[model samples]
Target: MEKTWWKESVVYQVYPRSFMDSNGDGIGDLKGILLKLDYLQELGVDVIWLSPVYKSPNDDNGYDISDYQSIMTEFGTMDDFNRLLSAVHERGMKIMMDLVVNHTSDEHPWFLASRSSVDDPKRDYYIWRPGKDGKEPNNWESVFKGSAWKYDEGTDEYYLHLFSQKQPDLNWENPQLREEIYSMMKWWLDKGVDGFRMDVINFLSKDQRYMDGNILDGKQHGDGSPYFLNGPRIHEFLQEVNQRVLSDYDVMTVGEMPGVSPDDAVLYTGEDRGELHMVFQFEHMDIGGGPEGKWNNEKWDLSDLKGILSKWQYRLEEVGWNSLYWNNHDQPRVVSRFGDDGEYRVESAKMLAACLHMLKGTPYIYQGEELGMTNIAFESIEEYRDIETMNSYEELVNTYGWPKEKMMAAIHARSRDNARTPMQWNDGRNAGFTTGTPWIGVNANYPEINAEKAYNDHQSIFHFYKKLIQLRKQHDIIVYGRFDLLCPDDEQIFAYTRTLGEEKVLVLCNFKGQEATLTIPTELHSLKATLLIGNYEQEESDTVSSEPLRPYECRVYLLK
Candidate 1:
């Protein structure tokens, strides 16, 4: 496989609104990020991926961009952004901005012009179609719930918005719009921004047929994802992006692609594809969801998680690269989702980190994940702040007549707001995130899980993550090594090996809360090994043994 800096580096994602609050504005700003530069540097991350900070109405929490060039007032001014960029570069770390070109805020100038009238020149800048028999243009449902097409009386036509009405999908078929996006990307690159995390990039191209999707929940409209996700023109548009703007700069780019398969991922990230450095696939994230979608209360099988991750690991080993992550701004906390977040939070967090970091990809750590933050339990629906969560709640409760307790249970397990709670810095009021009223309530368990406590504790999850990052920099095998999974059928343990030349490293992770025996293969049992790093501080024998691993224990050994 080809080598790249991004492949060898670890990325840290920060949701600016939840990261920190400065000036007591009840919101996190760019200057607050500047104040935490030393914190990130100490964590040893190579790249920082900042969520959307562009000018927005905050309808979808900055995903609905009103201006590509201006910074959101809630996030401070353009000067603050410039200083933050310079500070990150001076600290020897790269900063990546969120690129939400798949859609723009309805308040955006382009959308304002496109919605003026049917005959307007900018009308073609967005997807607009006449209603079909007094209904929507097609039987498509928005991701946030409801018809995908919204009727505009001014133009007497319908516009497509896959997410929310406030976020109108852009017309990628329009050459002028594509040029505008590329030009904006170049402007940021020229301003010293390192790269971009393109949001829902696969949804940029549509089928154009506007066919009705299969009805699933007996709702009038159906999920329109199949027609838009990874559409026919996705490759062409991405190649255009690569050739026009990305080719000129040596910056990393990772596309947020949902519903992408391993076969398609090869084309997207192939060494010569000229598309993206890597793509974030959601197969593993969707393992726990059922036919009803992510909010469904279903148990996730450990083997299923192993199968999904291993498939991508093996498929992309040679053809392309992978982007390994468990949590992000859009997903719930990892410890709560995958591991035992109650009694074994610290150990399971370290084990989960070791499992993904040992894979052949760039590891991404979401904000507060290094401290083993778990999902929050809001007492009532009013405490929820995510548009997606609120919409789903209303639909499930009022439309379907589902019990309020059941819907709230789903929200507790899957709401994006679970990840949007303020960063717990200390055990002070509002978790020391802000002196004033926080936009969202801080997690009530902040006293036990704050960063100040973790930093002071030598054996905390934060220090384990620091060691993992240090290991990646110290050993080249961790970056370019070939990966091989061992005991693939084991439901309780995850074991893998990374080999580069004569050097090899063995990684073992126990996913359960009971003692699990790791039987070494007979052929490899005699080899001598040295303990490289582990969550527990112990010197085991020099060779493999039939000893049982403790609950959520993670150990890495250097094979000789």
Candidate 2:
């Protein structure tokens, strides 16, 4: 495997909207991020991945960019953004910004011009076609569960949008558009930002034929796969993107590749791929999909989750690298999603951290993952602000006319709203996120889940995360070490070892909320090991005789 800084370091993602609010505007801003540098330094994260803070209409919660070079007014000015870059670099940490080029907001100048007239020079900048018999041009479905084409009366054409109608898909086939994106990327690279986390990068290219998708349940009948995800000429576009911009800098590039498979992951991030440093595959993250990408309360067994995770880990170890994540701004927090947040909140959080961090990959700790945050409970759908969730609910209730109760149940289980809540800074009003009303509601339990409370508690999830990152840095075995799964037969237990030269580190965890035991494999049984860091201190008996792990107990042992 190639030796890159990203291959050995841990990254933490911070949703700027929830990280902190400096101006009391109920929005997290760049100034608020500057104030939290010390806190991040304490957590020992090497990279702070900021979600898009670009000038936007915020139709997709800031993913819809109106201007590429400017910062959103709600986020502060470009000057504040530069100051944030300085603050992060000064603290010996790298900063990564979102690269959301799959589409731009309809309000963007490019889109506005494209929609002006059919024969306009900029009309081809976006995908637009004359309506078919006065209707949508193509039978494609939007990812949010509706028609992908929207009629523009003035232009006498329908534009394609894989997401919200306000966020029109960018035509990557245009060489000028490609150059512009690359130029903007180089500008950021020159500005000293460390890297980029691309949004839906696989969807950048689409089939030129505009073929129809397969009809499923009377929805738009077209091959959505061809129209979107890993479309024709995607790698060519990405390789060009890399050569002109990404390859010029030694920064990490993690693409949010939703439709990529394990084999495709190799192609996207392999040593010879020359495309991306890493890419996120939703195999593990998409365990429970509601009706058309929604979240549901469907029971997910631990074994299935472990198997999916192991498949990616083992496959990437041989092909490319994996971007390990338990939470992000688009998904619910890890602790609340996988671990028991009610009774074993702290222990389960720390245990889950230890379990995943020891694996051979670049672990990404989303903001508040270190504090073991739980899901938010919104009072009504009207209170939600995320465009994706709102559109989905509308599709179910308005277009399809599904039962409202059924939709609400799914929303509770899977809404992006769970992750979009403001950061819980303290038990103070508005969770100390903002002095004014928050753009989104705060998790009501913020008082108990704030950073202050966790930072002070020695056994808090925050401190455990610190130890986890430091261990990866201090020990070579944890970084480039080869991974081997042990005792794979045990459904409730997940265990693995990393072997670097002669150094060996073993990690064992009880994923479920019940105590479980697994016999040490022969290779590990005879090895003399010392407890390095654990969620709980080892009892005399546990040290003297390797005992079975209790519920949510995770420990790492270094070979002596």
Candidate 3:
């Protein structure tokens, strides 16, 4: 195993829209981010992974890019962005832009030109295919719930969109498109960006044959995802990308791969020869998405999640590096998802940080996650704004014949908007996100949970994260130590150990409400550490015993 610089660095993810608003236009902007440099410095992060701020039609938020070169006017001019880059570097933090080239807004110049006429020079820039049997080119369905191929009357062909129809898939098969994307990436690199977080990057290479999938049991389409996720020629395209732009820059790239397996991840992030530095895998996040399409139907036993993460941690440790994270712009707050938000919100939030940060991999912290934010509780469906959530909500009620109350329950459980709501800055009416009406409502608890409050509280989750980050940077073991599951078969205990030459850490977590004893392993007999951190009242002596641990108590014991 090689050294992981990312594991030693504290990464902060910025959802650009909700970060800051300088123009008073009720939206966050680059200038707004520039103004917050001091704030970020105070939080003590090594890198900031900014979400997309590219010129777009605002479909699927900013994930749909219309122009790669120009920054959205709403976000401020490119000059403002350049100043932000300089300012961030001045504060000793690197910047990583979100790369959304897997798909582009239909309004992108290439897509617009491609849609005008089939014979147009730019027609190959996007995936445009003639309808098969006068129907869609395949039995694939869009992630937004419709035929993947949309009829384009002007071109007399259908344009493929894995996500929204507004966002058409780019044809990676075309050398010209690949060259263009590489060029844009280099342009950002030249401007001094540290790296990129590729969005749904696995979605670029589609099944070459355009094969109609087998009809699902009582369902219309197969997980058409198989067609677009990690398709043929993906490695070739990634190698080309690395050779063209990434290889030349001292950059760190983390691909947002939704459906990739461990073997594929090895290819994408292996230490010996991989396309990216690391990748954000979806296995852990999907635990809450549930097996069915029902939004609020997410259910996970603590033991099951423990097994899932343990397997990934073990399997990927050998082949590739992992991008460790709990929350991002696309998912709900971590405390709400994995912890009992009502009773153990703050403690478990810090505990979750302790659990993940101790892993031998890179760790990413979403904006406000350090402050222990919880999920939003919207009163009406109209209050929701995310396109994905809105579409699913409407489907459950109007199209699928689900009761409104039942659908609302689902929406609360799995809606992406639960995470996309404006950042809650204060106790103001709009949560201080905007002086005027915000584009979306902030969680009402912002008053108590804002950064201001946390800055004052010494034992706040925010401060705990700051401490954990410092420890990760100073200690080599936390970064390179091999991991071992201490209690794999326990139904409620998620315990593990990270070992270096002579140092060791014992991490124990009791997931449920009842008190349970953690039977300390004999191998951990060398440790004589006091309780470094725990989610509950830790009853640790100078030396841990082979005693069962208490409930919801996650303790980290350092070697004395």
RMSD of each: 1.0, 1.7, 1.9
Question: How well is each residue in 253-348 modelled by candidate 1, as lDDT tens digits?
Answer: 999999999999999999989999899999999877876589896987778888889899899999899999999988999999989899999999
Give, for candidate 3, the lowest lDDT window spanning 10 residues: 288-297
Order by TM-score, highest first: 1, 2, 3
lDDT of 1 at 165: 98
Off by over 4 Å in 2: 218-223, 540-545
| lDDT of candidates 1 onward, in order | 0.91, 0.85, 0.80
How high is the lDDT of residue 230 in model 1? 93
User: What is the C-alpha lDDT profile of model 2 across 226-251, one tens digit per residue?
Assistant: 66788879899988888888887889
- Error (Å) of candidate 2 at residue 84 is 1.0
Against the true structure, candidate 3 reaches a TM-score of 0.96
Candidate 2 least-lDDT 10 residues: 539-548
* Global CA lDDT computed for model 3: 0.80
- Return the clash pairs for model 2, or none: 212-222, 212-223, 213-222, 213-223, 214-222, 427-447
Q: Taking the tens digit of each residue's C-alpha lDDT, what string does model 3 give over 25-88?
A: 7888898788777878887889999999889889888989999888988898889888999999
User: How close to the true structure is residue 422 of candidate 2, measured as C-alpha lDDT?
Assistant: 83
